[model samples]
Target chain A: MSAQPVPLVPVLAVVGIGLIGGSFAAALRRAGQVGRVLGVGRRQASLDRALALGLIDEVVDLEQAARRADLILLATPVGAMRAALEALGPHLRPEALVTDAGSTKADVAAIARAALGERLRQFLPGHPIAGSEMTGPEAAHPALYHGRKVVLTPLAETPVRARDWLTRVWEACGAHVLLMDAERHDRVLASISHLPHLLAAAYMAQVSREGDADLRLSLAGTGFRDFTRIAAGSAEVWRDIFLSNRESVLDELAAFERVLGELRKTLEDPDPRALEAFLEQAALARRLWDGRSAMT
Target chain B: MSAQPVPLVPVLAVVGIGLIGGSFAAALRRAGQVGRVLGVGRRQASLDRALALGLIDEVVDLEQAARRADLILLATPVGAMRAALEALGPHLRPEALVTDAGSTKADVAAIARAALGERLRQFLPGHPIAGSEMTGPEAAHPALYHGRKVVLTPLAETPVRARDWLTRVWEACGAHVLLMDAERHDRVLASISHLPHLLAAAYMAQVSREGDADLRLSLAGTGFRDFTRIAAGSAEVWRDIFLSNRESVLDELAAFERVLGELRKTLEDPDPRALEAFLEQAALARRLWDGRSAMT
Candidate 1:
């Protein structure tokens, strides 16, 4: 179904004003689709920075912001999302549309379902597949979501109005929106995004534990740098992601391990042809994927 | 001991005129430190391209080129080094200083010792820690090795004159030369370079074999791109590397598996604190290493 036309939101409340939240607020403000944006977070300094950068018009308490908002965007970590929803629950206007920008959709959906109770229809779970190896308000930019995919997992109980408004808002921010079930969204992301992050972290940890790690680090060049760049992401953030999406992440890890096992066996047996074939398959697949990505 | 001052070499022969060899020829030519560079390869078209690009002055056969050279550079794959060295053996001039740009030094060293026989003293196994996912003479650039590390794994029987001349030549090309034993060089590279390449290949292979691979690939972002960039390298070249350095690469793979096993257990057990700590350690280590690399 096509998204219905929605007018400018009177007031938008963005909780957890870090990279994702700040970027959303900035994008909305730049598009002139939000009359005023209110930033809410535990960190006063972060909220103040967001306001100063014009990402938001003002910093306000969560409950107060919820009361004033025509729409509320939950942009906290999935782990912190439950508490934010609970605190905003009582203060939320009866007609307010609620949405989130979390990585793991299933967990966030469950949390929202439990906390929002009767207001579940207002909650739309979204994940903007956009970011850098960066965080905080300083790292936020208006174009962060431009030309990126933003998947929305709207519950069966979700109102059509809420889903359509959220879609229109993300589209205004230059995001290409796709709709999917929470479970499928989580599984797909686990395979592509989460698994790669954990692998990079594990590789880095392995190298750091080496006897001659210092020497190895010295010899690391551009290849190593690119491969492990995601390992340098915030620990607190990734930890939440790994745990929240543990099941799917574990499945992907198991699949990767199996492939690695096959490769290890080939290496041990010294099968030149098999090894070459395996590497060739991977190289060809990656090149094809890269070509398609560049085109899109 | 210090490197001795060496005059311009009258003739230099570069076998396997691909990325590494072509770049070396171009750099030496740009520095005006060599009178003439002869390109030797199985592909006449590649050698002709090198000559046309001014990377070499002429194209010749291995034996013919070896006989006319004051210096010989074996710049082929590690697997091909043995055959190349054997072919150049009978035609080598007595005073010719020989070096290589192989990825795995231990394998190259063993091959050199076996094929060069009495002339092993003139052979220095070298690896220029510089390359791109691209290969071939067309990808060659004079500045490819500038400010890059060039590791030379000199054998015990290697003559000081051979080592000195090779070191000076690489220095003229703007590479910082470091000396180490072949075993140590291989082990260090296995930990840093080879291990990461195998990991990237494994990850790419895993994703490619997935049921919904196209979907997963569409969801991939910059993180996946950077992580798998090396996986797009020449399959023939990397396969040889993996096989030639099988022992060391397997050791690294085992170590990585152990770390991954621990991470998996932690994930299964649902330990948020433990998981956070693990991610934190890796992030800290990667950041510190990146800081040092940037400074250098």
Candidate 2:
């Protein structure tokens, strides 16, 4: 790609220099859209690794990040966002617009309101729906967000200029940015993302608990591997996500149970036609979704 | 792979020219283990496709296949197994070994017992745990079973000589062969393969029925794709599988419900630690399985 005549953002500070944060900086660097990246994190060794890995130019504290950054992105676990926002609130520059890469939006929006007070208007809650099983600076790659969806949940007081600018920046990272309200974003994520994760993990654990667990695992083929892939996601991150969006997740689980009940009825009925119809509904929809996804 | 000095089987008849049958033929051809592959199918077009794809040498009927072949493999969907066996029963040679690649073993074994009569001694109930979402001869590959698992659930009257020969044939296809009782094999498969497919299909159908389904599907990323991959399996095959092993599958579903109940309790309690602990169990078990699989 041709380098831009001028960087889009003079300085970008990334909090929690893990896969999301490090990859954001790398994507921006590849696009030649950011002049410098300042990494902030809880651990010093991780920052050093980020520097060694060329994921950052320098390491800085939250106070320095707030004072110097043209834009600041919080890529921490949602549980850590409130503290990061509180630390940044006191020193955050007037021109700086803040955003996050947290999975849950409503909780992060609430945290920003509570922590940043008046500066909360500058915060746009965003989540990049990308592979997240791998974490840390070592797992970061420039193309992590390429052709992925980045959902931005902007508040009422959020500036149009900042929203449009953030959208352009994510577009430079090869992400398609979509706008949604925080509550709706959280609910949508609970249905499509969080509930699936919980189900995979739960199924994996359940199968592992069986008396013939070893034989079952040994016999598991591609289907089991694919279905339980999300079960390998980081425990801490998922815990925070489940707890942060408990109500939505619980609601999705109930929905899943209802579907299972219907499936069980078909099985118990020994109704071959009904069973085939149920499975065919899923097969048809899955094929249609694949076709739809291929276009976009 | 190097060709065997002599063809392992002089004449091999495959009673279904779909993915499983075609792949088995292709795999044996690659290993130089079969002299001629006689294909039998209900559809002439599919049989022609199998021939054109080089998955079979020629098309033949069940009587000709039984009369002329040294070995026969019934790779048709489980629901069609009894009819196929019945067709072969009258013309079958006593020395000719018969094996099946059906997903459900207990039902197949029972069907064989009734149809094959005294010739049940020669039948081996087998399942090649390979990628199965893709069907038809075009989806078959010579290396489809490479580094995969093949489980054989032999009946009490099954001859050891035939069992040994089938094991070697599958090994030539680069699969690790394991033996289990038919009932246990069904239960193990129910827990691992069948249950995952059912859950994936059910989840995909449920998501498609949602009011915000378009939005939800648009936002779905790699996780959704992998989690629902198995829902794309042939509906008739999966329906037959679920019906054939209904009791085992229903038992697994009950087990799954118990696990989901525990998960729901933790979420409702808003117990972060308990939630984290639960997820960690699955993550740890899944990781261990991956490691074990890598080694084996």
Among all candidates shown, the one with the greatest DockQ: 1
Chain B TM-scores per candidate, in order, are: 0.94, 0.95
lDDT of 1 by residue, A1-296 (tens): 13634447879999888889889888887787878788888987887788788888888887898789998888887888888889888888988988888889998989988998998887889999998867899998889999999999999998887888889999989899999999988998998889999999999999999888998898889999999999999999899899889999998998998998888888998888899999999999999998999887
What lDDT does model 2 reach? 0.90
**Global lDDT of each candidate:** 0.88, 0.90
Q: What is the lDDT of residue A151 in candidate 1?
A: 95
Stretches > 4 Å off in candidate 1: A1-6, B1-6
Task: Report the C-alpha lDDT of model 2 over B1-296, residue by residue, as the tens digit.
Answer: 25647788889999988888888999999898889999999998999899898889888899999999988999887878888888898888878988998888999999999998877887889998886667788988999999998999878897888899989999988888999898998899899989998899889888988999999999998899999988987788789999999999999999998998898899998787888899999999998888888886
Candidate 1: tens digits of C-alpha lDDT, residues B18-38 = 889989888887886788888
Q: Can you write out model 2's per-residue Cα lDDT over A1-296, one digit (the tens) per residue?
A: 25558788789999988889999999999998999899999899999999999999999999999999989999888888888899999898898989999899989989999999998778988999986677789999999999899999999979999999999999999999999999899889998999899889989989999887988898887788899998988898889889889889888888988998898899988998999999999999999999988887
Off by over 4 Å in 2: A1-6, B1-6
Could you tell me how far off, in angstroms, the CA of residue A153 lies in candidate 2 after the best superposition?
Answer: 1.0
Residue A20's lDDT within candidate 1 is: 92
For model 1 chain B, the run of ten residues with the poorest summed lDDT: B1-10
